[model samples]
Target: MYSIVDIETTGNGIKGNRITEISIFKTNGYEVIDEFTSLVNPECEIPYFITGLTGIDNDMVRNAPKLDEIAHKILEITADTIFVAHSVNFDYNVIKNEFQQIGLDFVRKKLCTVRLSRKLIPGYNSYSLGKLCSAIGIPLKDRHRARGDAHATMLLFHKLLRTPNADKVFKSFLNAKSQEATLPPSLPKAEFEKLPTTPGVYYFKDSKGKIIYVGKAINIKKRVLSHFYDKSTKEVTLCSETSYLDYEETGSELIALLQESAEIKRHYPKFNRAQKRQVQQYAIFSYEDRNGILHLAFNKLKMAPNPLHIFYSITECRLFLESLCETFELCPKYCHLQENVESCSHYKIKQCIGICSDLSYTKEYNERVVTAIESLEETKTDYVIKTKGRTIDEEAFVLTRRNIYVGYGFVSKETSLTHLDDFENYLIRQQSTLEAQRILESFIRKKEPKILKFTAETTR
Candidate 1:
């Protein structure tokens, strides 16, 4: 038994969406055994655009029974029947959520006519209820209304039941292990099956092949599957529009992280919310205090005079200062890591050499500060971080010159990455972004990958 369902919603997203109208045609594959259709008062004002689409206005449902009132009837008819809809997830999820709001549990096996048609009936330009029905010479009346669409879907389902090999297809879809019902209606199963279970970045693209989201994972296929299983509003909406899957294996999480960051910044994909904002730049610089002691401090890049080092975030700036304080045996108070303290006993930096406690050590501390500043200049040396490539025979590298991320590249293991010049031929040159800087800096600090360092002259 299958209950063909269709719903006209208030157009809000999945969780918040309210059903204004619902229709169900209970069938035993070939003929309808029962039916239920109603205009439901969502208990909220219907948007004008929704009224424009389905012609179900506030006045129409004002005296009609609310969802809570009709809830029992819907449950009774749908009991012991498979849930069927054009795009089953939408209708099924909306109804399920509505039931939950009324303190009822709605759980039913779902079958999407959209995906089923693509499986049983192939080569249609579109699988939408209207388009597919028209293509197959099925009569569809009162389009967009719940009953009309549901009834047409039932008629179409009857035809689909008789298609060749449908029994095998239906059996597999009914198996809980199969993810056919979980995927977006428009996305082909083969598109998802081809994804590699390797460390890489994957793209979620719409039917037109426009990238909507970008993500990196250690297991590309597993991570992509997770999106389909996620019930979050953003995930649901993203998966709904996703019809194509694309990816590139990097074989290293570090490279994947950098690539994911760069792609997010470059494409500015709509579904990739993070890494879209501009990264704020902060700078560390030295200034002479009233006591004639040189002090190190950080400020926004534009506000700093004679900037010594730049960082992407305030946290990074403070971390760099703390490292400098510990290395140079300088007082955290002098570095502005701690404020308004008579002496330098920063909890993390116990190695302070009494610069803040005694004025006599000013000269020595000032000299060490100069050395620290010089170290910043030398830190700009060109380097290549070696990592695993997509294939075992190749190696991946992230290149940096003058302390700026240049790009990533893949080269055959036979190539001599002994010098920075070897990277030029295979390098995929990319613009530097703050997100990329954060990714590389984080990986270097945590993983400590093999880094080949050289000066400008050495590149020759």
Candidate 2:
């Protein structure tokens, strides 16, 4: 049994957007058994571009019955059928979200004709409903509307059913065909059904409720779906052992990062990267020896609280310190990491400030160390970093105030961060991470933004 479904929505995102139209065709192995279709009053205006593409406008749906009005009929038609769609996730989510808004739960096993066709009929340049149907000699009428798409998917499903190895493919989907491998008995089907495709973090737990894995994703639903599609041994094992699922919605990726860090540390999830043990092993340190000369060094001897920077590995810490030594003209001899030479190795190359050979003043060398320290400090004044939004016209920003790393937020292209308070509120707070740092550094390095103002620190 198959329930082929298609939907037109107010928008692509699920943040409260409503569905405007829905169509479902329930079929037995070879014939249609039931059907339902409707133009739903989404209670919102369909954007002009969408109307142009789908030929569905707000005016047309103004007097149509709302989704709640037809929810029961749809439920009845699709009951006990395997949900099918060109891209089943989208259709399923739109319907599920609509039902949820009306206090109804819609859950069903799903199949994607697009993915099925790719596996069954290889070498298609496009898998879109219209493109695939045209390529495969299937008649697709009324193109973008829900009923049209659903009908096309029904044809596609029928083809898939007749394809060679179809039985094996369908069995593979049931998670039952290959072997008698048992899945986590405690896992509820509802867990996978409700995971939204928005940015967030997810946790996997065993039968005893201990978190075995924790991960962050830009889209929770897609990431989780990936685990299911994966044929790898790790994914198979993880799926089998995943008895519980939990998630947190972070409105932004920065928040997700901070939360992931805190949670990983707090729970110490078993499957997280093994380098957790090396977090504190490497650090940048500033020290003044008995002679009252300041020195910057990469320290790996012991865990110390005076680290100017932290890294996951000693090699990375040493490389960065070495680069800084050249860039800031710091003497290597006083750094205590180099062995034996009186003048230090860099003096031969004239890269050092010569403090090691007593040619450069201690005060001058110490000033450069202070300059580097101040450069690394998060104490700079107000600044802004803008990035692309999920949509074309929208834009997002990471706002920094007096350089304490305040927060980030989004705005329209016409909006500016001129008002300090409003901009601050938009700023989302994020914990410092190599990821965020690298993102910012790469963005700044590329010279892409409008460049309101940005200044790299200099060794004073």
Candidate 3:
């Protein structure tokens, strides 16, 4: 049995958003047995953009039943059905969160048509409901509406069922348990059971309480259990040697990533290969030549007096150096890629502006080097990354000063940090790793967190 479901919500599929409409079609693989659809009064003002896309505005749901009023019907209809949706996680999580608010546990085995289609159908440019339906010549009406999309998903699911290997794929998916039935041999089931289904960092420890691996996940419980399901040699060994598990809830995924990198470096976890290495082995450095041109070069990290950028491996360092050479028209010989040659290959091919042959003036070549240096120096700014805390009234922050990750700490919302000294007071300083710095830098580039100039700040 399957419950094909769709929902229209008031905001992006995150916490605090409320559902404005829902539709569920109960099916037995070949035919629809029952159905339920409703306009739900979310009891909040729907955003204008959401109204534009979904066409379910505040006025449409003003007199409709609220979610709690119809929650019981939802529960009864969905009972004993495998929850099915185009993107299962978004709909499933929204419905699950709504149920939790009403003191109910809505756990269901879930199947995503998107995943199934990609596996069973294959070769489609997109798996989105409208696109996939159009490609297969399935008529999709009322595009964003719950009942419309749910009905379309039902048809799509029927098509997937008729594929050649559908039975084999469906059986495999069903046999895969939603939750782990067994834990690592040495681990206590109680400890694993207590793992939170929240964004955070988790540590796999040995019998001696030594951390063997550190990982971060949006859902800690699921990710930890996946480790046990792995059949790889390293994972098999990790599962057998693991005796205990510990975790910290980092309310944001960015923070979780940063924390995981820092923890891996601090513990030098035996199972973590990438982050266990010393901070950085190679770097890009700047030097002035006899012509007074600032030359960009790559060398062993230990030999660089003041490197502009740090890289974990020589290969990564060389790849970045090659990019800089292309970007700034620098000679390959100047970057140490070729030795005992009067002119670089790039110079002969007209790619280099003749920095090696002195055809390019020092001032012009130096300007390009400065541009490349500035581009790679992404962490030169001093700022704090503020994000949600474990609790509602508290907030978390990761501080960086002049390219160094100072530390991360939590503070009360009612209190404000008035100065750098106050911000430092709450910090639990740890040695910064190259991975941590890179994670923080990448997150800032992508998310663009709001910046506040803080001359005087206070936190409680």
Q: Go through the candidates in order and give each one's C-alpha lDDT.
A: 0.90, 0.71, 0.81
Best prediction by lDDT: 1
lDDT score, candidate 2? 0.71
Q: Predictions ranked by TM-score, top down?
A: 1, 3, 2
**Tens-place lDDT digits, model 1, residues 88-126:** 988888888889998999999999999999999999888
Model 2 lDDT tens row, 103-137 = 99998887777667766786876666798899999
Deviation of model 1 at 279, angstroms: 5.4
What residue runs in model 3 are displaced by over 4 Å at the alpha carbon? 1-199, 217-242, 268-281, 289-293, 312-338, 341-382, 400-407, 418-425, 428-460
Residue lDDT tens for model 3, 1-460? 9999999999744467699999999999999999999999988999999999999998999999998999999999999999998867567777888888878899988877876787687777566799999999999999999999999999999989899999987876666663322345456556788899988999999878999999999999999989876645577568767778999998888789988888887788999987777755787898987868776777787898798877778899988888788877777877776778987885333477777778556678778878888787653656677888877988888887656788888889998776666778888686667777788778879999855433323222
Q: Count the backbone clashes (under 3 Å) in each candidate.
A: 0, 4, 8
